[model samples]
Target chain A: MDPVLLLDVILLLLAVTTAITAMAIRDLLGSVMLMGIYGLLMAVIWADLFAMDVSFTEASVGAGAATILLLSALTRTGTRERTGGDHHLPALVVVLITGSVLIHGTSQMPAFGDPQAPAHIHVAPHYLSQDIGKVSQKSSDGATRRDFGDHVPNTVTAVLTAYRGYDTMFETVVIFSAGVCLVLLLRPRSPLRREQADE
Target chain B: MNIDGHLIAALLVLIGAILSMIRAAAGPTSYDRVLAVNVFGTKAVMLLAIIGFIGDRSGFLDIAILYGLVNFIATVALLRFVETKRLT
Candidate 1:
């Protein structure tokens, strides 16, 4: 077997195991830690898949920030989980159905890194080429002229910051609002409220 | 496929990661779990480096560096929480 493929499979299996164990564990702290492990495994899987940008995001946000947030929440909510009914048959069936549907959906997709894939047929070729910054202009006589491209060396950065700048900006805004909400929700109570309560 | 040195190293690190994950899952104490998670994070960094080298994508090292930093900060935060029971 190819080593990279072997690594990918192992990492994915580990991710699944960690996710299941994290959910099934009764101890909240243990569950949170297992979730962190799961995140790390996912980041490794992303790396193995050659999605380095996604790997970076998973490693920092999924593994790091998420763990810290959960741990903080655990401090406030207590570490022991309340015992609930153990019947999970319905949930299991739903999850199994979803998983099979997703797998079936992937069957029709192009193979990984296939140059002839539909996704590569449109704007992707231009994005990967040196003509990214160039724009074609039509003359009055119907002659098309191409402007000189700025020759952005890093296509990923150009795509993220230039082509999809608005999307990235909105994503940042969403994350920023989430952080603000967390702070607003978790901030210490005002002294005025404590004084009023004392009265 | 013939196994190369980098592949062997990755396999060994993967085994270590699996063991650490088991310890993290079957922890008799919170400290054990924390230590195990820390080890797991370190192993992830190693895996990223090895995989990056194998793929000939030097840009992956930047991600590996970021992951290393994040992992250390997370581990420190976890240790502090375990020690004090308070995040602040």
Candidate 2:
């Protein structure tokens, strides 16, 4: 196997182990912290997949802000998880079914970086050819254009801002709405709720 | 396939993360687990830097830097929340 592939597999294995351990742990705080580690590992995997924009988002928001939120919530809630319940059989079956379904779903998708895959065959070619800043290649007959090297080299930024502007706009709106929702729900209104007595 | 300095360094950092994970899972005190996770986050920053270099994308460095700053801030936030039981 390629070293890069080896690294990817190792990272993924670590992520899986951490996630399972997080779920199994009795201490809620430890589980949340492990989740933070899992987020970072997932960010690394996204970077390895060449989705730098997604990776950046994962690193900053998923791993960073989310961890703080979980920790703060933990402070409000007690850290000790209530010990195990009696019904493990149904839950185990559900988890197993979910895991298999997810794996099966991913198996049907094109392997990573397969250039001729459907997604690559689609809008990707358009993004590759249409350079706002510079013309990449002109046909010998001067009719067809292909190359667009002089463009906004970071096409992810360009595409997100230009072609998929609405999606990005809505995404921003969603994040802003989350903040508004948090403030609405969390900002203490009554004085009694203000001073939380330790349970 | 071939082992070299970059690959070795990345592997080492990951091993460190694994050890941190063990410590975080087994620590008697929540604080110890928190500290272990912080160390893991720091290792994650280094791994990101190495992975960025391996992939020839400088943008990975940007994520690594963000992780460094965010990880520190998160740790501090956790400590404050744990100590005071409320976030002002």
Candidate number achieving the greatest TM-score relative to the actual structure: 1
lDDT of 2 at B56: 72
lDDT of 2 by residue, B4-88 (tens): 6789999999889899989988998979987997998899889888887777778878888888888888788777766886666
Predicted structure with the largest lDDT when compared to the true one: 1
Quality of model 2 by C-alpha lDDT: 0.82
lDDT of 1 at A145: 68
lDDT of candidate 1 over A91-168, digit per residue (tens)? 999999999999999999999999899987987767776456567888789987665434555667558746587897
Candidate 1 has a DockQ of 0.77
Compared with the true structure, what per-residue lDDT tens digits does model 1 show for residues B16-52? 9999999999999999998999899889889988998
Collision pairs in model 1: none
Real contacts recovered, all predictions = 0.85, 0.71
Clash-forming residue pairs, model 2 = A136-A147, A136-A148
Report the Cα RMSD per candidate: 5.7, 5.0
